[model samples]
Target: MTTQISGPRGLPLSGNLLAFRKDPLSFLTRAASEYGDVAHIRMGPSRHAYLISNPEYIKEILVAKQAHFKKAKGLQVAKLVVGEGILTNEGKDHLRQRRLMQPAFHRDRIAGYGDIMVEEAVNHIEAWKDGELLDIHHEMMRLTLAIITRTMFGANVSSNADEIGHAIEVGLQYISKKATSVLDIPLEVPTKGNRDFQQASELLDKTIYAIIEDRRNEPEGAEHTDLLAMLLAARDEEDGTGMSDKQVRDEVMTIFVAGHETTANTLSWTWYLLSQHPEVEARFHQELDEVLEGREPTVDDIPSLPYVNQIVQESMRLYPAAWMINREVVENVEIGGYHFKPGEILMMSQFVMHRDPRFYDEPDRFKPERFDGGELLKRNPQFAYFPFGGGPRICIGNNFALMESALLLATIGQRFRISRGENEPAAIPEPVVTLRPKNGMKMTIHKR
Candidate 1:
C-alpha cells in the first residue's frame, strides 16, 4: 500500500496558483522542505501536481518510467514558437528528430566548433573599454546568439542580432505569459498580447526561412560546414530522404531559440555568482592564467581546464537556466510511496535540488571545488544535479553549451575582471521560458 501524499493547504479553488505566480522558487522550496520528498500540490481547482526532489524518485520518473509520461502542458506554449521540433515533440517524432540531429552534436563535430566559440568571445571583449558599465546579460545574449548563428549557419548575423534578439524576447514573453496564464486564450484572439506575439513570430519565421532558403539555393559543394548544412545533408537510412523544408525550418527555429538562450542565462548567472564570490573568482582566474598561459583556448584544452568546467558546473547547479521541468502522467504510476493517476503533472526543480544541504556541505555557498574530483557525483549518484536534465530526451546541446561556456569564460577571464556595477539592482532570476536575469546583469569591466 502506498502512503498518502501531503502538501500545502493552499487557498480554495485556486489552490497554490497565487503562491506559484507570486513566487515560484519560495513556494516550491517550502513545499519540498515542509512536505518532504513527495508533495502533492494543487495548482488549480482541477489540476493536481506533484513536486519531487529526491534523486531516487527523480530517476524513477525521468528514466525508469519515462515512457509513461509525456512533456507537461506548459511546453505546449513552446510549440507556438518552435513548431514540432524535438523540444516540444512527443514519442516517435521526437526520437526520429533526435536521431537526425545527433551527428551535428557528435563529440568530433562539436570539437571543430571550439575555435569559433573562442574567436567570438575574444572579438566581443575587444569592443569593451575599461570602466564602462554594461548589462552583462545582454552582452552574453548577444555573444551567444552570434556564436550560434555563425556555428549553425556559418553566416555572420551581427547586423541582424539586435532584430533577432528583440524578436526572441517578444516570443519568450508571449510564451511565458501563455505558460503561466490561468485561462488558455486562443492565439487567434486579437488582444494586444496576441498581436504582439504574432508580429514577433512572423519576424522570426521570416528571418529563419530566409536563411533556410538561402542555404538551399547555395551552389553544390559550397563550403557548407555548419549545423544547418549538416541537417540538410542528413538522410534517413531506411528511406534515403532528407528532412523537408518545413521540417528543416522547424528545427532551425527550435535551435535558434533554445540553443543560445539557455547558455546565455547560465553564463549570466555565472558572472553574477562569480562577482559575489571573490575567492572563487580569484581561483577561476588563477586556473585560466596557468592553463591558458595568455593564449586562446583550443578544444584540446577543455579537459585540462578542470576549474573552468567546475565553475560553470557549480553556477549551473545554483541557477540552472532550465530551472524547472515538468511532465504529464500518461498512465497511473507509483512514486515515492504515492499513487499518481493519469493526466497528473510532475514538476522537478533544479533550483530546489541543487541547494539541498543533504547533497552539498555548504549548499548555499559558492563552492566550485565541491564539483572538483567528481566529489558531488560521488556524494549523490542519483538525479540530484541535473542542470541539463537526464534521460534520452536530455538537451541535445548539453555538450555544446558546456564547451561554449567554458571557452568563453576562460577567454573572457583572461582579459578582464568584472565587478557588479554601482547602483545596479541586485540580479534576480525571473522564471520565464528560461531563468532570465530579471533586469539584465549590470557590471563594470576592469582590464587585467
Candidate 2:
C-alpha cells in the first residue's frame, strides 16, 4: 500500500520554488497548463502547497465540507496585524465573533452606510481639479479612510485618520513580507519589519483605545447609529453580554484596515478599468443621466444601473484585491484524485482562476458586457466567479464591499470621466497580501 501520488515537479526539495518565485501567476498558470489543473509545489523547507482552480472542486472544499478546513496555516501574521477579530478567529471563538459582528453589517445597517458613501464620494469628486495628475490610489485611500472615520466613529475620528492609515499600511507590509520571505523573524526578536509593525500597531492602538474610552461615556440609545454604536448595542445571543473593550478594539482595528484600504484599492482598480474603456464609460453616464437626472446615487438606484454594476464586477474580476487564500486540510481529503494528508495547505488562486480561459472567453479582455445577465455567469457554479470566495467562510463583508463599490462607481462615473493620463506606467501585479497595482494607477479625473 505504498503507492506515491506524483505531481509535476523538479528535484524533490527544490521543487517548483524557482518558477513560483520568478512570477507567481505565470508560474501557477504554467503548472496548471502542463500538469493539469491541480498541482503540488513546495515552499522553502517544510511547506507543501496545492493549487486548486476547478469550480465544483472549489465549492466542495470551501462549502459542502467546510468543517474539514481551518484557515490557512499562516494567518498568525494577520492576527499580528489586526488582532484576533473575526478575520483571525476559529471554531467556537470564530462563531462567537461572527455573531457579535453580524448585526453591524446587516442590510439595514449597510443601507445607513450608503449615505456616507455618497456624501464622501461627492465631496471628494467636487474637490478634484480637472486635468491635474493625481494618483487615484491615494485619493481613494484617503476618501475611504475619511468615510470609515466619520461614519464608523463619527466626526471626532477624522483627526486620527492619517496616523491610523499609515500604521495599517505598515502592518500590511509586515504581514506580506513575512508570507513571502525565505526567512521570517519572531516578534519577540524584533527585525526591521517587525519594528515597523510594532510601531504602527502602537499608534493605532492608542487612537482606538482613546475613542473607546470616550464612547463608554455616551448614553446608550436608538439614535446613535454608526458601526461602533451598533457594536456597543450588540449582545451575544447565548450569553446575552456585549463585547468587552478588548474585543471591541480588535473588531475596530479589523474594520479600519479591512474596511478602508481594501475598498480604496478595489475602487482604484475600478476607475482604472473605466478609464481604459470609453464605450463602457459612455454607457455608464447614459444610465445615470436617464435614471437619476444627475442627482447622487442612492441604494434605491443600484438595481437600475445594471451596466454600472457589471462594470464594477468586471473590474474586481480583473484586479481582485485579495489574490490568493490558503486553507488547511484538517483531515484526510481527496480532491481532483489527489489525496491530501491532514495539515497540508491548499492555496486557492483567485488571480489564476479569474483569468482562466476554460471558464471565460478571452479571459484577459476587460468585457463588462459578458456579465450583463450572461448565461455562463448565472448557469455556472457560483464558486467560478468567487472574488470574495464561496460558502460560509466567504468574506462577511461581501455585500458591504459590493454596495460601496457600486455606489462609488455610480456617483463618480455619472459626474466625472476618469481619463487615462499620458505616459504613466501600466499596472504591475503585486501578489503578496493583496493583488495591488504596483505602479499606483495614475489617472486624471475630468468633469463630465
Candidate 3:
C-alpha cells in the first residue's frame, strides 16, 4: 500500500494557488510544519506540487537522484530572461557550460576579484552622509551591480545603473508572476505583462551585446582578466571551439542577474539584521576592529574573522535570498518511500527548513553563535543549512558571494552603521523570484 501525502486543502479549480500567491513564505512554512516531511499541493486543476522539508529527501532530489528531475517551471520561465544559460539549462548542455565556466570561478581567480569587491564597496559609499536616511537595499543593489560588471564583464555600467536595475527588476517580476499563473499565456499575446517583459528583455540584450562587441573589437591579443574575456577565449577540451556571441550573452545575462541580485539582498538583509540585534552588532564590530586594526578587510582577513562569517550565515538563515528551489520530475522516481510521477513539482524552501526548530535551537532568533566552530552544521543534515542550493547545480558563485558579503560587511561596518528609525516598521520579506525586503530597506546611515 502506498502512503498518502497530506497537505493544506485548496479550492477546487485553483487549488492552493491563491494561498501561495497571497503569502508564499508563510504558506510554505506552515505547510511543512503541519504536514510533516512531504506535503502535497495542487497548483492548478492538473498541476501537482510537493513541499519537501526532510533534509535526507531533499538531498535525494537535489543530489542523489537529481538526474530524475529538471529545472522546475519558475526556471523554465526564467529562460525568457537568461536564455539557455546554465541557470535554465539541463542535461549535457548544462554540464558543458558548467565545464567551460568552471575555470573562471576557481578559487584563485575568485580571490583576484576580492580587491575589486572591496574597492567598489568603498567607492560606492563614499558619498553617504551621516544621519541621512537611505534605502540601503537600493544602495547595495547598485554597489553589487557595479562590482559584477567590472569584475566579471570588465564593463563600466555605473552611468546606466538605474536603467539596468529597472530592467532586471521588470524581468524578475514578470518571471515570478508567470511562474505561478494558471494561464500559459504566450509572449506573443501582447498582454500588458508580456509587453513589459519584452521591453525589459530588449534592454538587457542591448546592454550585454554592447559589452560583448566592445570586447571583440579590442586590439588583437589584448589581455583581459575578466570572466567575459575568458569565455570568449575558452574552448571545449574535446571540441576545441569557443562559445558563440549568443552563448556568451546568455551566460553573461545569467551571471548578471544571478550574481549581483543575490549578494545585494544578502548584504541588505545582513545590515537589517545587525540593526535589529544590538548585541550581535556590537560583537561584529569588535571582531572587525580587533582583526583589521582600522585597516580595510581583504580576502585574507576573512579566515581570521570567524564572527563576521557567522553573522552572515545567521542572516542568510533568517532571510535567504533564494528562499525556495523547485524541481520538476522528468522521470518517474520514488523518494522518501513515496513514488512521484513525471511533471510533478518538488519544492524545497531554504526559508522553511532554515527555521525548522527540530534542527535548530531558537530557530527564529538570530544567534550567530549557533554556527560557532561550524558545530551546528556537523550536528545537522547537510541540506538543513543550504543557503546556496546543493549538488551539481549549487550556485557557481558561492565563494564569490560569501567573500563579497563578509568583506563588504567588515569594510562598511568599520566606516558606517545603518539603523532603523524608531518610528519605522519592520521590513517585510517579499517573495518574488528572490526574497527582497518589500518597499525597500529604509534606514539612517551613521558614521561609526
Output the number of the TM-score-best candidate. Answer: 3
Cα error, candidate 3, residue 230 (Å):
0.9
Which lDDT tens digits does candidate 3 get at residues 180-239?
Answer: 999889999999989989999999999999999999998997999999999999889888
TM-score of each: 0.97, 0.94, 0.99
lDDT, model 2: 0.79
lDDT by residue for model 1 (46-82), tens: 8988899899988888899899899887788889999
Model 3: ten consecutive residues of lowest lDDT? 1-10
For each predicted model, how many residue pairs clash, with residues at least 3 apart or on different chains? 0, 0, 0
Worst 10 residues of 1 by lDDT: 1-10
Q: What TM-score does model 3 achieve against the real structure?
A: 0.99
User: How are the candidates ranked when ordered by lDDT, highest leading?
Assistant: 3, 1, 2
Candidates sorted by TM-score, best first: 3, 1, 2
RMSD of 1: 1.4
